[model samples]
Target: MENPPGTIGPGWLIKVSSRTARPDPGACPTHLRTAVRPLVAAEPPVPFRRAPREDFAPGPLFAALDLWEQGGWSIGRVLDELRSTRGAFRGRNAPAHPSLMAWTVQAFERYVAARHEEQAAARAAGLPPTVPVRLGWTARTKKKDAPDARGGQQYEHTAWGRQYASADGSVRDLWIPSLGRAKADRAAAEKAAIAHVMANGAPTPHRRRGDTPPEDATASTRLPERVRVFDFGCADGSVTPLLDWHRTEVQNRFMADAAPAFVSAATGAGTRPGASCVDCKAISGCAALHRTPRLWGAASAAPMRGRRSVSAWDLRLHGECPAQYHLVRQLHLNDLSAENDGARRGRAVDAWLNQRHADRPVRGCRDLPIPDASSLPAAHPLEGPLAHVAVRMLTEHRVLCPLNGIGSNEQVLVQHRVTAYVPELDVVVLAVPDLLYTRRGDWIWRETKTASRPVWEGRSLLRSYPQLALAVLLFSAGALDADPRRSWVELEHLREGRGESRLERIDPSQPAVVAEAREVIADLAQPLLDDASYEPTTGRHCHGCQARTWCKPGTAYVAEHPQGVGRHPDAAEADHFADRGSIHA
Candidate 1:
């Protein structure tokens, strides 16, 4: 019988199908294009390539698997999902299929099981389950319970000492052999040795007389019966020796065993006979007066031939400008050049003269003309009255005033009125802006040269040594009668410039000058006697003061009130302990 039209014989089926069917698009392109064709019913499933084991390490792969397993996904479920989301054949050449999925699932299961084992091991070791316990007081509490009779209870002290219950239920100390008393004994011995050395060390001079006897046996015995002089700020001890000689001379002249009463008076002591006593030593006497002037007489009188000789002791030089006495003893260091812009301008002009004619000697001229009375304008409110008062004061004192003038090279020249004195040999120059003398008794004013440009335009000279001025004032007022001419001011200029020579002059003031100088001397007298109100005026003048740091009002006030700020109780106790123990050494 003939077969149906739709049916084909089995023998012909393979050849006919192979000849009629189209190539599968899903087949590898390279294999499909090759000359040889496979005689198969369907394309063989493409083999997946496994990644090199070295490429993905076991650790990271295992971790990733553990994460997936912990999230409630089974190995097969995760693999299927991954395959659906990302094509099965993801590699360039071939699919990384079932093999990769199986390996990943196995790794995940192993990682999860390993992690659980690790947690169990940690718990077995008595470690915290997850979080760590903090160390310190929080980790433990102090036990107050006592041991019972059953067995024995053990307790630990903060110092790590142990206590154990005895057979009778009483607690007994469990000695730790390592903790010996030797260490504490050694430390105590060292401390004791240090303390003993300190106690036997030299003691500081006690301020209280009763605590320590005076070095000088006659300190109390030589009370007001002797006159004592103190020369403070005695630079180079120039005036000290002279005062000593003078004291000897007075003693010889009077043939007296004690200092003259006049000497006590000059020292700011009352004239009362029994008010004060003088120490034979100059420094001691001065210190005594500074400390206790009430015991010293206001006025010290020298009895020579039954007549009291005028004498004074106690010379002091303080402040930055000790050379001030050089000017004030002869001429006042007025605010004239200090205050007037014109005067300052003139000084600048003088500075230029100094630089231009450094080699040429310039003489300072005195007695210049004054401004015409008519040229002066009518008095203004502030300046006029001040000028009038100054002029009146000057006129009353019969002092001559000078006029301003312009010198060669457009330099302003003005004469300064002053009392003249003979310059002394071996004199110490103590200030800048000093005066130089010419053959004709004319005075030339000069200033010290500084590396920096002058604050005023002209070259400036050190005028007067403030220390010297103080010395002179004190000496002339008989403050250093016991140590006269033994001291003077010392002026030091950093570098040499115009008029660089150092000069010195005796503190001899003219009669009229001395008269006016006495008034100033009196004004400053109280300060030497320890008047608290006697503060040095603040200004540029304070810039060079030696005691500026300690004497400054603000600093002094703060130093006096340190306790005003709250202090910790512990700190206070420490300080108290330190203070008490300090003297023991």
Candidate 2:
């Protein structure tokens, strides 16, 4: 079948990556649609060049597997070859970091051991021996059977992962590798991937770009009796089987069930303008995204830096410790540690409130009855005293629900992305208010925060909650396209106790308010933009820093401060229970 035409819209030859075809529950519907149905631009968007370490593990790891399959090389020989060549396997051009090379070598050793153990177990059970196969499978629906079935659209489904097959082709296994801890894939997606591969599975291996397929590059005559999917943990060398399905299960249950969802995602409409806008092919004409240039009021003297994004959370982290921001935000490294109780409670409360406010017909929470602690769902994050606290916080939210004053026809966007760009800084300023609504054509930004303690006494609201400061600047600059004279930025602080919630509204039209917001933002953003070296600054944030394991300075500081307490008088006295949640939430 020919590739889809270079057009962007809901109906077209939809190309779906079975792995990401169905997005998470709260993911942007527009993003999924756009991705599957991309416009054929004259000049395709340039892919970002990630750090060398990010690409190190997977390439060498797969190459080692191929080498093992071809030559049956010993583990020691494999490691020696890889180390000697510095991972120039498969003609890789990018340099590998020394640390990453060491990590990958260890990962390969673990992977081989795990693979051998699995093979041994299979042999003991009288199953045929397995061999590594690199082929990817694709399942396609005829143009007549596409989402717009009658409109002549075709859909192609494909899965991504390491592949293996029994010598007799009785069983096939898809190994999904993770550099860190093994995480479970979404159930629907996993099933869909299995269905896709099984429907058109072949013994052929994956070919690099421009590589010619073998003479027998066709679907396997005999389908595997059993399909297995495993998530391989490279960090600790653990193998977790995620799915085991018979051919009947894939055809009768999984395929029939997943087809509709896959179609719905591909045909999804509506623009959700946020981080996705940065790379969206249709962004130039997207009316959904509101761009406010220079909203941060901070310009970088270095104009050569590529475009990047900054949020209130980024600002706060950079303000506290630059290294934490870089490691956690930029490199996307994590220690896989559990969050503290207070932080978890805050998230639970926020989720609960968001769910309630998202109800149809624009109903307010003022009249809704609060749930009792005992009735809370087991799956709910709230538990014990924290459940009670979350319940109480919900009760406090009743009085401050933004929907109370909103009309049914007025726009109500809950946790919607509001973005701005700072051209001078060559950075995007991103903000997602907890709730945004309009009254008589005036835009109102509401940020709901859960705190165990009351609002910090005598502290500037903008200083305490920098999101409100960003909100103010956005409204002042007319980013939201509402009446600037009446637009307001609101902070609804919900405390644990009854009747302790505070609702403070700032008039963004005022010059003084805008000045204060600008100052607050600049104070946090200037150092982040100007500083190239993200040096670690030890303080209270290290206690909750997820990237501490990767930062020597942070690790040392944490060791010295075993109690996770800060010695700084000002920060030590700061309210630690406050929620520093993500606005890209």
Best by TM-score: 2
RMSD of each: 49.0, 5.5
Score each candidate by Cα lDDT: 0.24, 0.66
Clash count for each candidate, listed in order shown: 66, 3
In model 2, what is the error at residue 534, expressed in angstroms? Answer: 4.9
Tens-digit lDDT string for candidate 1 (1-585): 111121222111111111012223222222221101112111222223232121221223333443353455576665555345322322322222222333334434443454355347645965333221111010011222542331112211011111111222211111111110111111222222212211111212323312322344223221111111111111111111001122223334322321121111112221111111110111121221222121111243221111110111111222212222111111111211122322222233233323323323332222322322232233211144433432232222112111112233332222111111111110111112222222222223322212111122252211222223333443344332323333332222211133322332433344433344444434333233222122233333332222333233423443555553332222221111110000000
TM-score of 2: 0.76
Query: What TM value does model 1 have?
Result: 0.19
Off by over 4 Å in 1: 1-464, 473-495, 500-509, 528-530, 533-585
